[model samples]
Target: MPRTILILNGHPDPSGKGLCHALGEAYAEGARTAGHEVRRLDVASLDFDFLRSQAAFESEAPPPTIIAAQADVLWANHLVVIFPLWLGDMPAMLKAFFEQVLRPGFAFSYRPRGFPVMHLKGRSARIIVTMGMPALVYRWYYQAHGLKNLARNVLGFVGFAPVRDTIVGSVATRGRESIGRVLEKVRELGRRAV
Candidate 1:
């Protein structure tokens, strides 16, 4: 069945020629070829305050861009996020974007007891991350900390299930051939609407 997909380019680079951006485009292309509806959000192009004060969090009204992003999230059956890892975490802007868009009430709401009910259920997600170190080293040595944080903590917390990831590492050392192979793999994933 054809599904609605949202591709979020989280690289914080508006020029859109880096590995992360390329991967995002490849995925979008594949998804479109597979007859899925696709929408894209490049974080760098979004005009919004990245700094979220406590008051902002408490407020019901978020910035206009954030509201729009939340609507996108609600619209998508699947989400694909492509970003480069810097210093073992997502870029500050990407992290801040998540903080703003996945706000309370939109992503989740508290219960009288126990965990909050997840409002964004019935959605799945895939995370494609590029990094400087080898992929295995990042997975084994660093315990895939960043992926775990996003897949388990953030996305899962919001009720995005079956969150999977692809870690493309040694990006700085990889040649065009290797990068092209990675892009193809990402495209295949998109083709399946994964």
Candidate 2:
């Protein structure tokens, strides 16, 4: 059966000639070609307050758009993220989105004894991360993926297992061909995804 795929463009830097956006487009185009319904949410273009103020969290009066975004996440069978690795992590806006949207009752829960509970599962996820540094050096030096552990580990704890990741290393120095190669790989992944 056909599936619904949600794409999140987390790059805060807006560039008409950016390689990251191209990667996202390539993945979306490939997913569409493979007969999956695709929905995209570009964080940079969204007009919502990113700050998690006390009123924003406790007042039950979040912006209408945030409410809508939560709905979209729940409706998808696949989740894909296209973003740059700024300072070894996602943009602050995207991270803030997680803080706001991935609320306790929504994305996860807790056991009676203070154990963890998961609410999102039965859906696959993919993250296409671009970095200015080489993956090996970054991994060795940083001793980490330079990515969000929550998206894969925390979310994976609940039900989003097998969260696939695509790392576009050396973005700051990659050539046109290198970028194309990464895009091609992403496209192939999208095509083969169930």
- At residue 154, candidate 2 shows an lDDT of 46
Q: Candidate 1, residues 44-111: lDDT per residue as tens digits?
A: 98887865477677565877888899899999999999899989999999999998888777898878
Best by lDDT: 1
Score every model by TM-score: 0.97, 0.88
Which regions of candidate 2 are displaced past 4 Å?
14-17, 51-59
lDDT of 2 by residue, 1-194 (tens): 67888888888765534877787788888888998888888777766776657556544555677778888889998888777877777778887776677766777776778757778878888877878788776667886554547455545765786787777788878778887788888888777763
TM-score of 2: 0.88
| Clash pairs (backbone) in predicted model 2 | none
Instruction: Report the number of the highest-TM-score candidate.
Output: 1
